[model samples]
Target chain A: MSIIIRGARLIDPGQQLDQVTDLHIKNGNIEAIGDLTGLNAASEINAKGMILSPSFVDILTYLRDLNQIQKGTIVSETQAAASAGFTQLCASPDTQPCSDAGSVISMVNNKVVSAGFCDLLPVAALTKELKGTQLSNMEALARAGCIGFSNASYDISDNNILLRCYEYAATFGLKVFVQAQDQQLGDGHMHAGATATRMGLDGIPVIAETLAISRHLLLMQHTGVSGHFNQLTSAKGVNLIRQAKAQGMNITADVGVAHLCFTDTAIDGYRSQYHVQPPLREETDRKALLAGIKDGTIDAICSAHQPHESAAKCAPFAATATGMAIYDMLIPLIQGLVDAGDLTWALAIQALSYNSAAIAVGKTPKLSVGEEANLTLIDTSHYWTLNSSSQLSHGTNQALANQNLKARVKLTVKRGLVSYQM
Target chain B: MHNLAELQLTKNGELRHFLTPEGLDRLMLERILDTADSFVVVGNQEVKKVPLLRGRTVVNLFFENSTRTRSTFELAAKRLSADVLTLDIKTSATSKGESLLDTLQNLRAMHSDMFVVRHGDSGAAHFIAEQVTPDVAIINAGDGRHAHPTQAMLDMLTIRRHKGKFEPLSVAIVGDILHSRVARDQIHALKTLGCTDIRLVGPNTLMPQGIDSMGATTHNNMESGIDGADVVIMLRLQTERMASAFLPSAGEYFRLYGLTTERLAQAKPDAIVMHPGPINRGIEIESAVADGPQSMILNQVGYGIALRMAVMSMAMSGQMQQRQAQALVSSSLKGEAQP
Candidate 1:
């Protein structure tokens, strides 16, 4: 199928291109760019008031299914992702039955193919069963179609096991995604600060992330492997990653959209939905995360889209499951950062698409001739409310369930096919 | 704060539930203390039963073990002539795959009009209070380090009887404020009652952060905190504090922050020493200080029943009034106005 997006403001930060142009797509590839005044096409989108950018790539997302279908499923969540304008989402390995084997990776790949909404990249576990003990068959799993290797916050407690896993990953050329959290220091359900104290819930101090990040950064340096920090949630963590990147270490980091939006104060009411892993830090941390993204200290902005069933999140704050359905609200949240002027549209595009794609696939789609037509059409001026009724994911645990925001994904074209339209 | 105080009140600020000491003003605190004043005499009566909650069923839903707190609540309910059912929740249907809501619904069906909840989670009482039907009253016995309103109120009753007024009092609360729901509730209660010079004395690790923001001054040293204070509250140190990195040993804690004869002497000569008992003698308090002449610990226990009775009667009255109002609203909506 051939498609043409007319008069859209194209922002491809990777190629340093930002201009109002028409994009012509044919056979799932970018056939042409610039003026095609008299060109005929199978379908035409009058995207005059839209911002066309390279489709978003989310580095950390939970596509919970298999035994954990109560949380979410591939068909439900990927559809949610499509509407959120995400073209590629790397699913975390923290699902039930832990995605550590080639069989599980192939099962997810098959599901993604059948769902056919957005591209779902499976991340295999670093250790066997993610038990922090023996290593998994990384070479086999990587070849079985895993985008990367990650334990997904499962503590590799044995230092020697972690080093061995990284060393093995480095040799196999598999990207290792590290969730920096010291399990011992992360004793509490929410951030360790005034809010946790006032709520009388135990706290996970900022040291949980920073201390673990420092330890992992040392191991990453020692092992000389490509490491990506996933869902970092602290000011000190931002500074640590910044120093590492400045020191020219092969370390990249991504902050969750929730971390950029909310602080520990959001849990003041003991709202369980606000309870999250590496729980939301203070306002200073939120500011630092935004600043990190703006100054290129953080490489990407991930949805950190953890979907949980309603019953799973309806308990007391400390006892409830820690995560939220964020895929459907990802773009609007990033747009909030852009509208606040804390992040330029170019930087937002770079973090959402270019940087994330580089970490996930080593390549990103572009708005040039011969490039694939994986793109997101966004209406920055459009206002939408994230109400319960509008949700598509099986999990209804949205922390921002009724939040009103600007910016809506008008269309999501994945490989020249109109995957989602609103 | 926990918003439990707000949840406990009716739209017009009547006490519909008694969950936490926060959000209560000096007037409200005084009202509770005043009501408790009359009930204190009732506890001294040969026939202790009152008909205030007659024919009403009060269920003590203790999800966490506390025989002492439960007995006080049970005595208070019995004294108010309410039929009480004490359910040890750990052995109840909650362990038989029954969800909390299901158990609550079953209890409600059994005509349990009031629930006294004690649980291990911080907001467990609030969660139960929120789940109950409109006419059902809920009182928080204690919820994980969050609040113990009745205990705080009883301490207030003890304080007012001894010190006469809160404004002229300088109270020092000693020991582990971090893990004690009693301390948090007392802090809120004291602040609400206009007790300005509230001092929290403990090690930094044993103190809840930002607690001083609730209008109390924090002191790391025990002597400076207790000096010239009119009331001294020595909190019992839990053994778990030692297991955590909060304290080195029970002996070390006693040496640094324990209420001994010498340390008690730092307070005013007439200053009363109080402990929310099951006192850890030699850990949080010395036997001499705990059994000392200035010790109002026994008086605090005596007032506990009266304070709890006052809370139950007040909350039940509020619920009854609200239920009547709801009935009138529904009747009027049906065009059956009495007027």
Candidate 2:
């Protein structure tokens, strides 16, 4: 269907365009930009005070569709993603059978095609079944449409095997995604600090992240591989990444949006919803992460959208599951950051759209003519509470539920199709 | 959601759930101590049963193996005239793959009034109190490294019986403060009970980070930690500490921080030594010191029965009062609707 978004503040970081303009989309591609008021279409959106940007790309997310359909399905999660203004998701490989084999990749692709809410890029496992012992068939899996390779929170204890995996991925010119964490030191549930001590819960020291980042930096440099760090949660970790970048390492990194908004204090009273992997760090670290984003040291911010069933988060803090169902509240949270003046609108859009797309698929999302119409219109002044009735994700494990938030996704056009609308 | 402290109290500040000592104020804590003092008389009587919870059912939900603690709670419930059911959860439905919530729900179906939970995970009792069955009273027996309220109360009772007042006392807690739920609860209770001179004695490795901010001072040397102290409470060093690299050896620990007669002499002449026992004779304390005249170790265990009875009855009464208030409110609403 053809459509027109009229008189909206169109901010496209990829094309370096920011202006109140009208854009025309015809047959799933941008037909024209700059005053399309005279153009007629099948549908029209009067986005007068809204901000329209390229639809977000989440480089790390868990669909949990394979054997854990009880947690989430491809259709449900993609619909949630669409509502959150994300039109592309890089699905992590920690599935039931894992995305190690070419068949798993094809199965995921088939499911995504059938679902058709958004594009799905599967990240194949770096090791067979993610056991960290044997390497997976990376060359074959890459050819089967895997976007990248990752071990997904599982640690490769043997340095030699990890080095070999990096070297092999480098040979195929494939990007390797690393979730840096020292397995032993990351045994605790939350960040190591005074708060964790006060609450009597075990703490995961900051070194768990920095130590892993340091080791991975050395390995990436040694193997000459394209590397990307996922979910950095500490100040030292950000500094290390900055230093590595300054030393001319061709690498990029993304921080989880939750880490930017919360700290170890959020886990007070043992609220299981705040329990996350690479658990939230201190305030200084959160500020450092935001600074890293503002100064362009951190390239992107991901929803890190791990959706789980209610039962997963119902237990005591440590025994409960480790993630928040973030898709339904992702945009409002980023908007909250912008509203609080911690993030500029342009930088937020660039990190969520342009930088994420470039890192994940090596393509920049643009609002120029002839580009695909993957964009969302957001009502920045709109306010709403995220109760169960308003939540769209199948997972009810949202930590931000029942909280008032500014901004809402008013319209999302994916490849000229009305993927979502309020 | 209400915190553990908030969940433990009613609107007017009555005890509802005894989850932790962290939230109980001086008045509430003193009430517990006073109630236990009255129950001490009941313990001395021939027929030691109270009619406070006569028809109530108290379930002893032990997820971890704790023979001593389970028996104390079971006996306390029985003494309160409540029907008691002890479930060794490790060998029960938990092992059969039933979740904690599912098991608690099934038990709640049987109309139990309270759950005395001893779980290995921190905040387990709070989860039960808040999520599983809000109507049922939850008495935390020992939840991970979080709290052991009844134990702390019993220790407080022992201290009060020996020494006059908490304000005039210098209390020293020794060994394994990092991993002891008892230490955490004791710190909170001691602080609330007006004990300002609280010293935590152990190696830096055994001390929890930021515990000093909780109104307790940390000392690596036992001599300085116990100097001028009126009460010395030693925590048991778990055998797993060695396997986990928390210590070099039991002998080494004894040599460094153990409570020997010589170390005991560092405190006041009449200072009392206490251990939440199952104590290691040579590891955390010397046998001579543990069995000495100034040792209040046995008294702490003896006070456990009365202390548990006090908290159980108080929390049950709080729940009953809340339910009755709710009933009155709903009945009044219904009456108004009839008009």
Name the top TM-score candidate. Answer: 2
**Top candidate, metric lDDT:** 2
A1-422, model 2: which lDDT tens digit per residue? Answer: 78888999999887788899898989889999888866788888889999999999998988888899988998989888889888889989998888899888888878987888888878999999999999999998888788899999998879999999999999999999999999998899898787887777998988999899999999999999999999999999999999999999999999999998988888888888899998999899999999999888899999888888888888888877899899888888888788788998899899989999999999888888998899989998889999878887788789888998888899888888888898
In terms of DockQ, the best-performing candidate is 2
DockQ (0 to 1) for model 2: 0.53
Model 2 off-target regions past 4 Å?
Answer: B91-97, B337-339
> In model 2, what is the error at residue A246, expressed in angstroms?
1.0
Q: What are the per-residue Cα lDDT tens digits for candidate 1 across A262-343?
A: 8888887678778888799888999999889878889998888888877776655556778878987777887887777777
lDDT of each: 0.86, 0.89
